[model samples]
Target: MPDTFQRLYELIDTPRFAQGGVPRITTRKSAEDFAPRDEGLDVLLINTPVREWSYPNVLPIGQGYVAAGAIMDGHRLTRLDLNADRRVPISTLDPGYDAWLFARLDEALAGEPDVIGIGGIITQYAQIKKICAYCKDKLPDVPIVLGGGVASAMPDFMLKHLPVDYVSQHEGELTFSEILHRIEMGASMQGVAGVTYYETDSHGERTAIRRNPPRRTMTAEQLGHMPWPLRHLWDIENTYRVNPVGHLNQGRKWNQGAPESGGKFSAEMIASRGCPYTCEYCFSDYLGTAYRSRPPADVVREMEYLHYEYGVEYIEVLDDLMLTSYKWALEFYAELHKSGLPKRGVEWGGTCRTNILANDIVRAAREGRGNMLELGHDAGLRRVAYGVETGSPTILKVIDKSGQTPATIKTAVQETVRVLGYASCSFMFGSPGETAETIRETVDLCIEMDYRPEVFFFTTAYPGTVFWQLALDKGLIRKSVDGTVGPADDGIIERYLMGLGEQGDAVRTNFSDLPDDVLLQLTNQAAQDLNSHNSHRHPYQDGAPNSIVRDATHATI
Candidate 1:
């Protein structure tokens, strides 16, 4: 909270204001605060801190926090469950929070954990930097290992910039556990695959950096059997300020009935890993494109634990692709049914692709009691909104999205109405080959599909994707971010790029046929025509961090 800093500012400024001059008093660390600290503690894992301004949710818990569960692969989604078991003691903490939150960090750090693992995403760079800087300042000898989406996205960037000791990309289960083991046993990281670190100068500035080739992606079996996340490692309940019963929520509403403690408990989980199909704009597209599915039994078991143990009556699956394999869907349905987990276990939804939703697949997904499937703008158009990125097949082919032809896309969107019961669609305005004629083609396509426009996402080039290279070649993104510091407000770049991803003005386009002003007008026209459906549901009603989600739908599930 800002209360602490605000009060200090007042105390110092009050004196200066009395004399009608600016306060020249400087604030320095107290003797006790700046005292020498021990860096030879045990293991400490951190989930970088967050605030409401940075992350808008019904609750203020940070995103990418589920790294513990991720390290366990898709099998476990919450950490509180992991700490209950005999596992590694790298307790996760979000100490960069309020005063009370700092207390929780103090308790976790009281053990003086020597190895610290910090989990973060791209948008949390500034916060992660602040946390790592503080940790190094206090415990200079301890090794701070950074991992998570941002690390996975750009391992070299983190190694070159942040004051971290080590960084790991991609799946961290094998590598992180190995790193921890070596540190505990007094070994070296020279042979560790998927690790990067900097050789720093005496002043803590990076002098040299070395990164190893990433380890191969985990096998399907490896992902399914990993241990659960160590949620017990952190005081999450108090840290997130969770008020499950009633709080501002984004996206779909989950009717979890009534919360045991007025909706005080909730969680987000991932049931699968990677996506089968490749889209140029996906952040992780640059990483290998192969996808993996967790065993259904393992997925259900995680759900069972959360529903019963954490009192998480509602859950949301945050997966790359929640529905793909028909065989897996059938097995998953059987597991959920046979397990006899309460209705709470199935109250969820996840993103699906256009080609994954066959009749049998949809039928199997609907077997759950409280499940739902939400489609991304570039998803399988069944009951969800069709992703009509552009009307022109020429543009589609140019962007290497020939998979979404007029026939295939229209048929899917039309069939979805009966199979899933509602229709929403997403469109993109600017890309490599967008032109006036292409824009018209998109508008006409929306008319044909009867698309209920949800939101228009003006796409950008994320670092690991093919689009990133294209953007670079075309001068869209000019400079490399390795040595450069990002905006002081880490969220600025993400917010500016996505521009309220659900609904807002599009970001700058790199289209060839039209200027940005013309592209804007064409996009607006297409949006109006697509959203012209009389029954178009409000997009905000189906945004993120909802009450519950499912792989398919509420009526069928």
Candidate 2:
């Protein structure tokens, strides 16, 4: 869930994929060249697919990056991203499909790896268990270990319900290493601090709920000790295609003049882990509550590496809150400027608060080479949504997002426009206390901001957010979108099956207390008003990155 690989790479003496400390392996089709034979290899495979319904998004692609990096550190990984290989015939949610998945597993194991480790973000537990069962059945001797964001969130539930041999809780880098070392030494798993295991009672029935005591949370320094995620393990260039709604795939056409225009040399880099903002709708709070940042020097070095090796032109810091500290931002930008890298102007973007747009930060972001920003202005009725579930400040307070408000948000938006000439604003619909009128206010706010020639929009609530919880509690979510509620786990598929476009109800909100037509009309009108500027197209060379051509470049106050 967090960037574990980035930290490890930071600790490395040299961060090259082909360097000596890392494992040597080929990703994608290259691995297939080896004759199929079980080498009796012991591997630790982590699956990141969050849910069964999420299968369409999983494929070995992303996991391969992590696994490949570990393999460079002398670990073997059988990465699985079910989203990538959609052609597989079996259903991921069906426990009966283990036989089918195992066939591929066996081919990979090929007697090469003696053990297989699996980890994921929780929702995939059912599917992961089926795979675990298959491993036990085929290679009964191999150990199956599980750990991930989900393991940390629901360790007890995972231990009890799944066939997973061990569940590593909290940050997995250290624990995973400990587990692997113990395995290599053939040590007992009983004393591992982050592990949970089961032992049969004298009655021969599953009885005891055994667990290792809690351990300390990992620090950024500690995290920096691991290997950089092995990007070589994945088909990095092709990963954009794995997701149906992946932004890269949206409106993408290959071989077109617009498509060929690659954006600046900026690379998406992780400067820190954990978000300080506790918006209930985020999983970050569920996994980590504190904020941590990598040392600035380490970050600058990575940038230097990017410039020398990859010809990267700019940087996109992928932190949840890159602007959490003004001092950190200033220092990082200053250090980066001195890295002796190419002076190619760079553009960066991230989620930040309007409060951070102080003159100094704006100057650095605008003239200092950082441009483009994403501000989360969840609702215009921030207050009511907090208490009465309206966009009132009171409502925002109730939802624990009091930091967002129209005044402060407006200042932030204006600051971006003042300094960078443009920025993006995100408003979440279906929030508590929300109604058509409140939504219209938000729409009106977007229209007002539209004059700056920025972006505006809404996104459906994905499962696992606090917003979804509220939706469920409000009975706004139901089974079989005929607008009826039912009692059942609803299997994750049904929970997310609002069927949006597929059911001809894409524009309909399940929050039935409000008139459906009214809600749709307001939402549509807001979108229409916001998009009014899209027709007055800015003259941009087709493939240019959206950031560089905008006024945000020299708009700083």
Candidate 3:
């Protein structure tokens, strides 16, 4: 066996593994033996800190879904949102930063949770590791469960590395609830669907990993019945005051062209799940290949709740693709018009495909008011962002951007800006076939659109994406064993994940034919060129720290 797999074997060979039972891997340091509580399980769900500087600190909607499911199953849920805690210093350089995080964890553990759950995206691997290690050390007997993109993408890697008992794969709402139910009943997790767990032998030693069958994506009816995300668990007012919905109003200028709406607060909502297209670099399939949406009236009702409860003036629909079908968009917008939020000065924005935006009917709807694609000067549709990954037609095909070409991208962005007065476009560099000429084409297209774009300097090959497999095929990602074509076990994979968090916009791997230095220089120059066109440049675009600062002195812990 390779050294990495050997290390993994040793790691699992612990006292916890020896304490085998229905829910194995629970060995308490204290004298008391582990036992399932008769009453409801005290579940603690943590929303790990994302790179707050790059992204806004919105409500933990994903965790909220999981929490809602657990609550419905008679489990007590306590949420710890590390991202929304302004008391914690933002600077890792601060001396008390690590101590502060530990202290916060200690406070959260005061409830003595029966099972601890944590989650984040692939870029938050390092932070998730810190949280898992801390929780395991503090409560040795308590089971730790991980979910979200990190666990769904690389279940085996996370199971081998982190001190997690189980990984809730893919859509976690149903899976996590079932896991809790099984544990409450003191039943084995062997047949739990959409979960990855370790199966131990009679001697209580872990023999192998067992991944249950994937849970099917929720149907439209199921989605509509699903409970609303438990947003009340979070500090909503503070999050709005600090983060302020950056999707449409990044520079707080999205409303500059429209009439002065007195609304100040903001919130986020999602009306749909999954995307129809399987872009090479995206992990959309993790949510399943099918596109599912909630009822239009139900989504509009949630908007009304946010607007009234949180005094929200703007809402950023964070759906992967809100406008999946033309019919869905029309129905959703009709409900929005009926809610009268637009007349009440509540504006919202979401992502849409280039093809959908380029349609004449869609454009006309956007140009007028009281319709789905409303883009009137005082319209509720304040902004629309396009995932125009590249302007190079060759690279477009390379990434499998369905039905989108250079012309369609140009027309959609140009028309959006023509009607909305501004539109957000995102671009990425260093794909499998990226070249110097292709990089220039992307930059030139951004300039032609006359809109500053969010440019990601490196094309990260997130696990479970086609880009990741391509990287492995090209030897950009290497495994521990020689001549083995599988996921890397040797710390290479972990290091790659850590690099994603640490390097930020800096290049981690050169997927393109261009050399590393050449790619970096070209990407940096492209960002500079794009920055030159617009007066206001984003901090990430120029590789600078954002102006938002956290209070370090409030480290009361």
Candidate 4:
């Protein structure tokens, strides 16, 4: 065995030992695990395996929400979290990994569900494609539905290429329930809002595609009233055991700070959905630009459950932009403090914007002794990551990071470091007009703030973002001379999506004006400079000297 796999096995015993050292083949739990109602449609929700090496697996909360909505509307649901069932180390690197995944899928389909729904992000495009094809072959008559960001972003392309019968667009809880209701009633998908389906001929040949009107974004009240995620369906214990801390809190001292709690285990949750900002590189607009958050009380209730039931000592809030509304942030912190989770040793982290953090500091100064950071610490906010994507003003405008300038970025980082003990800032290279000088500015900004730079990512053009369209317009995403990129050119798009799963620090596609080699060299040099500058820093948790501890960084736009 390779040293990496051997070490992982020795450390965690994650891989099962079998004859000839092959990992055991594990399948989803049998249908007997869930009792389906006779009157409702039998819906199977498949949580396809993501790139596990990219980050540790968490309960698929997005699919959990979908399952919650289905059950609420009188539908029988069976969930298959393929990401959780792997019994092998470095499974994706193994040649038989795809076959093993298919075997698990086949076993899950043994009941022959009435309808199948697959949810994943764009990076899982290849895996999802294989899954959809396998399902079509095995259960030819069963209708397949696709949801989540991947389907919502490029509904037409997905409908034309994949074997999906319908693409459930944004905020899938309501739209998915409506899809199930229609399916149960044997109704046409014509007027179902927030969906993309095909119009078929008499012989069931797809003739054209019909995209229904977009659904209105859900309100905060509606989000609060939605069912709590069906976390019971997943192996929460195994998840906690195998990967205790999420990418955001990897090397933080808090992971080991709470010795009184015995040991630390982590889980991820989202307090809000949809980002209000329109950063050109992001595809969050697929769910609409309205920023809605669940009630603070409701959010705290869930946290309490995780704490008392699952012993989750750490939480990673996966909000797109957690600090969009300062009023909402304050309310959440107040509720969290009132719940006393912090006293019980629960610490959470989330992504934040520099403009919001800077403005919050200003408000704190005006209100009292500028104890906002201290108050948050008391409420269990351990880490706050800011997306200072670029230091150059020109690149900032190009990426449409509204209200963020170099001055604001500096102020936010310096203030966060002074008040919170440490600050985390993530930077990206290879914007549309990126140059060596812009890269230098970003590096200089990092040095000036005395913050150790995490990984620097190349700006990737995901399918539904403005960057994707720019790549197409600039002939980066190629098409035929006739100016049509259809199913025939599926390979072109598929290759690009596959490339997205590669290491982020490496150049994927050079959107910058600089040559590819030059861009790579600059990015590497910037990483080294930042690391060398902060080499002496040490991790600080409670009442320790503030410094940026080395932590694993993941790409976030």
CA deviation > 4 Å runs, candidate 4: 1-36, 87-93, 240-242, 252-263, 369-371, 479-489, 502-505, 532-557
TM-score, structure 2 vs. true? 0.65
Full-model lDDT for every candidate: 0.50, 0.47, 0.70, 0.71
Tens digits of per-residue lDDT for model 4, 1-557: 42122211121122232212322111122222334456678889888766554333467887877776666555677877777675222335456777777888888899889899997899888788889999999999999999989998899999988898999988777688778877876888988889999998999788999999998776776566555676767778765333555443445322221112434777878888889888998888555558888888878878887777787888888888877777777888899989989888898877888888777778888887444456677788877777788999989999999999998899888877776676766678889889999888888888787777644667877888888878776666543222443332566776666545633424555678887667766766676667632222222223333323323332221
How far is 128's C-alpha from truth in model 1 (Å)? 2.7
**Candidate 3 deviant stretches above 4 angstroms:** 1-38, 54-56, 87-89, 252-263, 360-372, 375-379, 478-488, 502-504, 532-557
TM-score of each: 0.65, 0.65, 0.83, 0.84
lDDT of 2 by residue, 1-557 (tens): 54243222333334452243433333233333333223223574645333222213223322443454345435545555443443222234355444545656676667556566676544455556667776677766677777665566556666766666677765455566566656665766677767777756677466776788755554565434433344434333443222322122113211110222444333345567777766655566423456887666666666665455445444445456656665665556666567644344433445566545544445556665443232211100010001111234543554576456655555566655655445544444444456666676665555565532222222233345665566656555554344656433554334344232211124323443455544444544544456522212211224231211222111111
Per-residue lDDT over 1-557 for candidate 3, one digit per residue giving the tens place of the 0 to 100 score: 42221111122234442332112111111112223334679999988876533333468788877776665555677888787773332444456768878888999998899899998788888888988999999998899989988888988888999999999886677788778867766777888778898998899788898988887676776566566776777887665434566443555432121112443777888888889888988887656558898888878888888888777878888888886676777677778778898899988888888877666445565766333344322437777777887899889999899889887788878777776776677777788789999988988887787767754446767788988877777666552123333556547678777756432245555678887667766766776677632223322334534432233333333
Task: Tell me the lDDT of candidate 1.
Answer: 0.50
Q: Write the per-residue lDDT of candidate 1 for residues 142-221, one digit (tens) a residue.
A: 88888777677777766656778788776655566556545655666776777887655779666777787776676576
RMSD of 2: 11.2
Best by lDDT: 4
Of 2 and 4, which scores higher on TM-score? Answer: 4
Model 1 weakest 10-residue run by lDDT: 23-32
The parts of candidate 1 lying over 4 Å away from their true place are 1-41, 49-112, 199-207, 232-266, 285-289, 341-345, 358-388, 423-426, 479-513, 524-557
Clashing residue pairs, backbone N/CA/C < 3 A, model 3 = 366-373, 366-375
Q: Pick the candidate with the highest TM-score.
A: 4
Each candidate's clash count:
27, 58, 2, 0
**Model 4 lDDT, full chain set:** 0.71
Q: In model 2, where is the ten-residue run with the lowest total lDDT? A: 379-388
